[model samples]
Target: MSQVMKPSTAAQKLGILLSAAPEDFQQTPISREDLDALRENPPQWLQDLRRNGPFPRDVIAQKLGVSNSGLARGGLTDPLDADQIGELLANPPQWLEHERSVHRKVVAENERLKAERARQGN
Candidate 1:
């Protein structure tokens, strides 16, 4: 017997919106094997979604090079599609710039701390 997962869980694991998924996908639970197969050889719809997404918060944050909290602080509460993300990249707002700068500083600080710990044999 195949292990089954909820549609919402499948959507989360697949990194696509449940609402945007096909009716069959949204309505039906997926098997573990099927999910793995989807990952290994994605269908056109899956490819399209991954490529031109109203992506999840984490994906949006990654694309914008900022943290999820930064996104909220910057007033980006809605999901963004590929076009919107591209537009933002082309003409970044002041908030985006600020968030990016802050993210850079945070990353640098974390790296510095890691190096210090390594040197101290932590």
Candidate 2:
């Protein structure tokens, strides 16, 4: 024979269990003074440049070492300047995609190794 517990009683039991760990409790309060200071002295325009859209198309093309016409054909006409082009060349999107693909392959290999180890009881 089993008794059906009421929702309120079950909730109370759960609350008791959760409240038992006083040592595990922590508090993190944001300081109003710090927030006020941040509001007063905001970040510089150059520091927040990413808020602007992607660099100009010609700049991206230059960094990629291709002609502006070629880049325009590839649908990248954002109008980046010389400096932005240099930055883009140093950290190209295609390089990021390649790195991501490599990461996925490594993760898959690790998962396969883990499964094999589990099967072998190691």
Candidate 3:
């Protein structure tokens, strides 16, 4: 049996949103030949995506200086290009700031709890 690639993997490799892709594109099992063709001679859309990414969540979060959970809380589900991430950094909306604040608070609380637990053990 030939190796089968998941759409999620393709999305990660292509830097395109899986939801944005056509159902056939997302659902099809790309054979090794098809995979090579996609890489060697990509469609215009794929080429555009390669040049300008619909970057993965981790990349976006790092660019935005926010945690992944903060990103989700800020309601940023769609993939973003560098420009978009830059825009958020330049002028963060209220929700983005709020989510970052919440993330900081959560981290502080976790640290405090950990210290308390250590103290109780002693």
Candidate 4:
């Protein structure tokens, strides 16, 4: 039997985020055969993803110099292309600044706590 891939699984293998994908992708299960077919003869969107990349959220966040949580909090549902990321950096919104601040604070606090714990030997 041909293995069936849920939309989520397909999205992962393709290195794209589920929320970032097109609506049609979310609506169905993709069989392995169909995925193989796409791989052989890519569509425009597939080409774009391959060329720009179906980047995972972590890579996206890091490349953008923001936290993963910041991305989520900013309602960034789509995986960004390099151009999109560049645009955001060129003119970041207030929310992005706020989220970056929050992420920085959280990281600082986490480091402090870890250091404290180590000192206590627990």
Candidate 5:
């Protein structure tokens, strides 16, 4: 017998928002096999989500090249689609730009620290 899990668990495994999922999907408990099948051979809805997105906050942050905190500070708490992300990239808002800069600086600092640690052989 297949093991079943909560919708939220399935959504986490799928890297999607449970609320963003279809109503039926939100209501259903998914099996492990079902999750595997979805991963292995995604349906049209999953494909569309992966491609077009109303992506999760983490994905949004990654796409925007900023931290999750930056997104929050920029007042982008809601999920964002690919088109919306694209629009932001094309004509970034002041907050977005600032956040991107901050992200870049943070990344650079992390890289620098990593290199320093490597050089110290520790």
Candidate 6:
């Protein structure tokens, strides 16, 4: 005779299956190495879009799945000026603080190089 499965056992098996499923996985944060790579060699699409001008900060922010202010503060939009960079560095939006820190480091390096070049009269 065929036997019926116990509800608890069925539930446990379902839970196990769900947990094992790749589609049920949660997203992890981007790693610093990955972000640095992007900064060093931004994708062709991004370059083309940025050539026109900074994409609308809000739109780019939405595409990146972050808030507009976060994108603005992270220097991810395009062609940010010194004043904007200063404001961002002073008080970054919450979600992008880590990424912003990385960007800040890059910007600082760029500034240091520029200053050194100026000092050398190059």
- On TM-score, the candidate that comes out on top is 1
lDDT tens digits by residue: candidate 5, 1-122: 88999998998788786778889889999999999999999999888888888889888899999999999999998899999999999999999999999999999999999999999996
Candidate 4 local lDDT, 5-120, one digit each (tens): 89988877776667666789878899999888877887787667655765678767877667987899889977677777778788989888887778779889999999999999
Give the winner by TM-score: 1 or 4.
Answer: 1
Query: TM-score of model 1 relative to the true fold?
Result: 0.89
Q: Which pairs of residues collide in candidate 4?
A: none
Global Cα lDDT for candidate 4:
0.79
- Tens-place lDDT digits, model 6, residues 17-103: 212223312133334454445357866643443443333444344334455565756557464433554565576666566654565
lDDT of 1 at 48: 95
Off by over 4 Å in 4: 1-51
- Which digits, one per residue and each the tens of the lDDT, describe model 1 over residues 18-101? 888899999999999999999999999999999999898888999999999999999998889999999999999999999999
Ranking by lDDT: 1, 5, 4, 3, 6, 2
When 5 and 6 are scored with lDDT, the better candidate is 5
TM-score of each: 0.89, 0.27, 0.54, 0.56, 0.83, 0.27
Give candidate 3 misplaced runs (Cα > 4 Å).
52-56, 81-83, 93-122
Per-prediction RMSD in angstroms? Answer: 1.6, 21.0, 5.8, 5.5, 2.1, 18.0
Considering TM-score, which of the candidate structures 4 and 5 is the better prediction for this target?
5
Q: Which of candidates 2 and 3 is the stronger one according to TM-score?
A: 3
Clashing pairs in 6: none
Comparing 2 with 3 on lDDT, the higher-scoring candidate is 3
How many steric clashes does model 6 contain? 0
Q: Name model 1 segments beyond 4 Å from true.
A: none
Clashes of 2: 5
What's the lDDT for candidate 1?
0.94
TM-score of 6: 0.27
User: Clash number for every model?
Assistant: 0, 5, 0, 0, 0, 0
